[model samples]
Target: GKGGAEAGAIGNISIYDVDFVPLLDAAGQPVDPNPVGHGLTEIDHLTHNVFRGRMKEWSEFYERFFNFREVRYFDIEGKLTGLKSKAMTSPCGKIRIPINESS
Candidate 1:
């Protein structure tokens, strides 16, 4: 059972596939149907809050090597809260590179 769970964990850690879609003009209209040459349309910001130490290094690495940026940092007090992550963006709103450091 231990080996089986470890194998499953390893499998989950790997991302095998990704999907790309077209972006709209905010009026619910399809801007483009083609995806291959289009690349990512946006860069959404996501975060991982309430995490332990050395976790932020992973994000920092992406920022240094992968062009990601560390935009904002927040410290929640007196209660369990989420850290707000921030970054730059491209014209389209589909190519998000989230580098979150949990507090």
Candidate 2:
């Protein structure tokens, strides 16, 4: 039992038997899978809020520091709280962080 758990931990979660099956189109040509933006379609955004004018600076900061890009900017108009916002997402579309500011 010595070092068994440690050795198991190293390879436990790894998937090594990946089958490289080429996806074919209707005409039977292999499809190219390398797209420009790496993304996960179904993801969530962690909305971080700030004051109105600071939104741009904060968004740019995220883009420059982290590998995040601005996907959408929105002007939210709720009855009680109106806000100006922009949403930024990671390269894989996971871990989205939306920055909002009260308007």
What is the clash tally of candidate 2? 0
Cα error, residue 4 of model 2, in Å, equals: 41
lDDT per residue as tens, model 1, 1-103: 2334333234445222222345678898877665576886644555443246654666666667666555444454436745444443323444454444445
Q: What is the TM-score of each candidate against the true structure?
A: 0.35, 0.52
Q: Judge candidate 1 at residue 13 and give its lDDT.
A: 54
Any runs in candidate 2 off by more than 4 Å, and if so which?
Answer: 1-43, 78-81
For all candidates in order, the CA lDDT equals 0.49, 0.77
Q: C-alpha displacement of 13 in model 1, angstroms?
A: 31
lDDT for each residue of candidate 2 in 1-103, tens digit (9 for 90 to 100): 1424332223444232223457788999987788567656664667797976999899889889987998988897899989887889888777799898998
Q: Can you tell me which runs of candidate 1 are displaced by over 4 Å?
A: 1-43, 80-103
TM-score of 1: 0.35
RMSD to true structure for each model, in Å: 11.9, 10.2
